[model samples]
Target chain A: MAGKTPAGSARSDAVRNRRLLLDAAAEAFAEGGVEVSIGEIAQRAGVGKGTVFRHFVSKDELLAAIMLGMLDELIDTASGLTTADDPGAALKGFLTAGVQIFVRDRAFCEVIGRPSLQHAEVRAAIDRLCDVAEQLTARARDRGLVRPGITGTDVALLMAGVQQTAAPLLAAEPQAWRRYLDLVFDGITASTGRELPYPPPSHLSLA
Target chain B: MAGKTPAGSARSDAVRNRRLLLDAAAEAFAEGGVEVSIGEIAQRAGVGKGTVFRHFVSKDELLAAIMLGMLDELIDTASGLTTADDPGAALKGFLTAGVQIFVRDRAFCEVIGRPSLQHAEVRAAIDRLCDVAEQLTARARDRGLVRPGITGTDVALLMAGVQQTAAPLLAAEPQAWRRYLDLVFDGITASTGRELPYPPPSHLSLA
Candidate 1:
C-alpha cells in the first residue's frame, strides 16, 4: 500500500486506457477499414480524441500496432501448439487458426500488406511467423507426414494463398475456403500418408 | 494489282506501323511495368511519338488494348482445347497457360486489378474468360475429373491465386509458381483417381 502512490495509480490508469484504445481501435478498423477516423475510435473507447493520440501518434501507427498485436496472437498460437505426436495435424491447426484470424480481422489483413507498413517491426513479426512455420514443417517432414523438400516458405505461401483467395468468397459462401485449405493440405502431405487427388505435373515428381 | 496505288501503299504502311507499335508497346510495358512511358514505347517500336498517340490515344488506352489482346489470346487458347474426352486435363492446361501469360506480362497483371480500368470493355474481356472457364469446368464436372461442387469461379479464383502469388516469386525463381499450381491441381482432382493427402476439414465434406 505504501508503494501505491498517485504516480503508480496514474501509470496503471494509462495502461488500462491503452488496452481499451487498442480493443476499440481493432473493432472500429475491422468494421470500417484502416480509414476509420480517430474521433470514432476515441468515442468507441469512451475517451477524447486527444487520448487516442496520446496512445498512438497517427492512424498508421495505430494500424501498425494492431497488426503487431495480431502477429503476437498468431505467434503465441503457433508456440502453444503441441506437435510432438502429430506434426502434420499441428501445422494444419495453426494455419487454420491463422487464416481465421485474417478472416475475422480484415483491417489487419489489408493494412499489413500495404507498402507503407513493410517496416522492420512488421517484417520481424512476419519472420517470427515463418520461424514457427519452419519448426512445424520440419517436424512434419521428419515424421514423414509432409513431403520432402517442402520448406517453411512453401507452407507460409500456401496459407497466405488460402487467406487471400478466401477473402472474396467470404461474402457469398462463408465456408468455401475450407475446401481450398483441404486441397492445399492434401497436396503438401507425403504421398505415402495420403493418396494424391491427382497426378503431379508430368515434368516434376511432386512426391 | 491495279488497286495498289500510293494511297493503298500508305494504308498498308499504316497497318504495319500499328502492328509494330503494339508489339513494341507490349515488350516495353512487360519490361518496364505500367509506369513505362509512351515515348519509350514509341521508340522501341521504331515509330515517332505522334504515331504512337495516333494508334493508342493514351497510355491507358494502350494498356487496355494490350489487356484485350491478352484476353483474346486466352479465349482462343481455351476455345482450341480438345476437351470432349479429357476436360479436366484441358482445363488444367488452359489455366497453366494463362498463369504463364500473366508471368510473362507484368503490365497486364498490374493493370487488371486497378479500380479505374474496370470499364465495360475490360469487364467484357473478363466475362469472356469466365465463359471459357465455365465451359471447360462444366465438361470436367461431367467427366468427374474434378471434385464435386467445384465451380467455374473456383477455377478462376485458383488461377488468380497462381498469378498473384507467382508475381513476387518471379523475381527470384521463375518456375517456382509451378509448385503451387501442382499442389492446387492435385488437391482439386477426384479422390477416386488420386488419394487425398490428409483428412478433409471436419466441418465440410470436400467431395
Candidate 2:
C-alpha cells in the first residue's frame, strides 16, 4: 500500500497541475489574447514551464484545448435550452451564453481566424456547436418565432458577427454586445415576411 | 516651355507612379490582406521597391491612405442617400455599398482594428462618415421608416458585422453578405416597436 500510495499521489498531482495550467492559461489569454506566452502562463499557474509543455505541446495546442473546453460548455448550454418552453427565449438564451463567452475571452475571438482553428478536434467541436444551434433555430422556426429561411448557420455566423462588431467597443462599453445581439435577434425574429437575399452556406467551415 | 517640359514630365511621371502604386496596393492588399508586402505591391505595380517607399513611408501609411479613400467614398454615398426619395431604401443602399466595399477588400476588414485606424486623418474621415450615417438614420427615423433610437453608429457597426460574419464563406459564396445585410436591415426597420437593450455607443472608437 505504501508503493501504491506514491503512484496515486503522483497521479493526483498531475491532475491538479493540469487543471491549474488550464485555468491560468485561460485567464492569461483572456486578458492578453493569443499572444500570451506559455512561460507566462506557467508562471501564472505557479508551475514550471516544463509542466505546461508536458500538458500541451505548443501554444496552438493549448489554444485548441481551451477552445475545445469553451465549445463543450457552449454545447451544453445550447443542449439545455433545447427543452426550453419558449423557443424564441431558448434561442436567445443560447446566443446570450455564446456571445458572453466571446465577450469575456478575447483569446476566443482572436483565435477564430488563427491556424489553431484548423485543428481537427477544434473543428469537430465547432461542427457540434453548429448542430446544436441548428436544433434551437429549427425549434424557433417551427414555432414561427424566427422568420422563414433563417438557418442555424446564419445564426452561428451572426453570433460571431455580433462579437466582431462589438469588439472595438468592448473596452469602452463591455455591454455593447448586448445591443448588437438584441438588434440581430430582432432581425432574425422579424415577422415582416421579408426573404433573405441569399441562401445559407451549405455547411459550417470555420477555417 | 522646353526647359519646363523635363521638370513637368518628371512631375507627371511621379503622379502616374503614385496612382499606379495606390491601385496596385489596393488590389494586392484586397487579395492578401495587410500581410501583402510593399515589395510585392511594387512588383505588381511594375515599379522598384524604392518607388513604394518614396510614395508611402510604411505599410501603415499606405493602409491609412487606402482606408481614407474608402471612407471618403462611403461618406459620399451616404451623403447622396440623405435626400433620396425613399429614406429606408436609401439607408439600405448605403449599407449595401458599405458592405460591398468590405466584401471586396479583405484588408479593409482586417485593418479596422490595426494601428492604421489610429492615424489622425483616418480617424477624422471615420468621424465624418459617422456624422453622415447619422444624417441618413435621422432622415429615415423622421419618416418613421426605421425604428426609433437607431443611430448611424449602430448602422456603421452592423455593416461591418455583416461583413465579418460572411468573411469565412466568401471564398465559397462571395455574395453571402447580402443576406446578413438584409437581416440587419430588417432588424433596424422592424416596425414591431421593440426598444434596444442598450443606448447607442456615445462615440466611435475603432482603435
Candidate 3:
C-alpha cells in the first residue's frame, strides 16, 4: 500500500470493492431483491456508504455486477460442455448444468429477462452461448441421433421452456425441475426402439 | 347499483377495487419492481388511497390476485383441450392455446420466482393448473398419439418450455416456441412421411 501511486491505489481499491459489493449484493438480492438498498449493501460489505456509491455509480450498475457474476458461472460451465467428446452429451450436460445454476441463483434468473440489459456485450455472450447450443444440435444431426427439422434456436427455446417449471417458489417439490427435464427431453430425443402408438398429426402448421 | 344487499354491496365494491388495484400493480411491477408503492397504485387506478387498501390486505395480496387471474385462464383453456374430438389435435391445439393465454398476460410471469403471496388458496390454484397439464399428457398418451414413454407431465413441461421463449415481453417473436414445438412433436409423434432428419439415439440415458 505504501509505494503505489494514487491511480494504482484507486485501481486496487476498486477491485477490492468490486468483489465485496458482488458478494454482498448476491446475498441481499437473493433474500430481498435487486432493489435492495445501496446503504444495506455498504453496511453488509462493512464499507462506508460513500465507498459503495464510488464503486457502483448507480443501483443499476451494482445489480449488473451481481448478475454478471451469476452469468459468468453459467457461461463457464456451458463453455466446458462444448468441449465434451460427444456433442449431444455436451448439450445435455450444459442444460443440466444451467438448470442447477439457475436453481441456486434465483436473483439472477429473476432479472436476466430485462431488455434494458440488451447491450452489445450481453448480446455477444448470448450469441456465444447460442453457438454452443447450435453445435450440440449439429452434432446430433450429423450423428443421426436427433430428428430432421430441429435447429439451434429450437434448442435454445427448448432450454428456456424446460426451465419454466423450475420457478423457485412454486411450493411444489424441489424435484419439479427433474420432471420438467424429463418432459423436455422427451420432446427432443428421438425414440429409437419403441414404436409410438399414437396417430400421426394430419399436418403441421403454425396457425 | 342500489338494489344490492348491504353485505353484497360491500363485496361488489371490494371486487371493483381489487380489479383496479391489480391493473395498476401489474403495470407498476413490470415497470418498476415489487417495491412499487400502494400510493402509486392508487394514483394509477384513479382511486382514493383508502380504496386500494380496502380491496387488498397488502401489496402482496394485490399481486397474487393478478397472478390468479392469469392462471385461471391457463387452467381453463388447458382443461378445455381434453374435450375436443381429436385428442392429438386437441393436444396441439390446447398446448398452443395455453401458450397464447400465458403470453396474453405477461405481468403474471413476473410472479414466478418472486416472493410468495398467501399460500393456501394460491397453492390450490397452482396445483389445479398442474393437474390440467398432467391431464393433457395422460390423454395425449392414452390416444396412442404421444410416444410410448411420454407422460402427462411431459406435455405440461413442453408447453411451459415454449412459454419461456414466447414470453410476454418477447411475444412478438414466437418462432422460438414454434421451433420448440417442432422438436417436441418430432420426438414424440408417430413418424409419418414428413419426419425431420435426426439420427435415432441408441439409448437415452436417464441422466
- Model 2, range A1-207, lDDT digits (tens) per residue? 101123334678887887798899999998887778888999999999988877776777887888888889999999999999999999999999988987788787766544334567877877788899999999999999999888877787787789877866777888999999998899999998667878888765554
TM-scores (chain A) of the candidates: 0.80, 0.90, 0.73
lDDT of 2 by residue, B1-207 (tens): 101123434677887888798899989988887778888999999999998877777777887788788889899989988889998888999999999988888787766643334577877777788789999999999999889998888888777788878876777777888888888898898887668879888755544
Predicted model with the maximum DockQ: 2
Q: Quick one: RMSD of model 2?
A: 5.3
lDDT per residue as tens, model 3, B92-171: 87677766544544544545433254344555666676677667767777877775655544454455456664442353
Real contacts recovered, all predictions: 0.19, 0.66, 0.30
Which digits, one per residue and each the tens of the lDDT, describe model 3 over residues A1-207?
111133434677777776787688788876665557888988898888888767666676667666665656667776676667887777677777766655555555555454444434444555565566667777776876565555555555455555665553234444556655554565566654533333222111111
Instruction: Write down the TM-score of every candidate.
Output: 0.67, 0.87, 0.72
Worst 10 residues of 1 chain A by lDDT: A198-207
Which runs in model 2 stand beyond 4 Å of their true positions?
Answer: A1-17, A35-52, A113-117, A204-207, B1-13, B46-50, B113-117, B204-207
How well docked is model 3, in DockQ terms? 0.24
TM-score of predicted chain B versus true chain B for each candidate: 0.80, 0.90, 0.69
Error of 1 at B187 (Å): 1.2
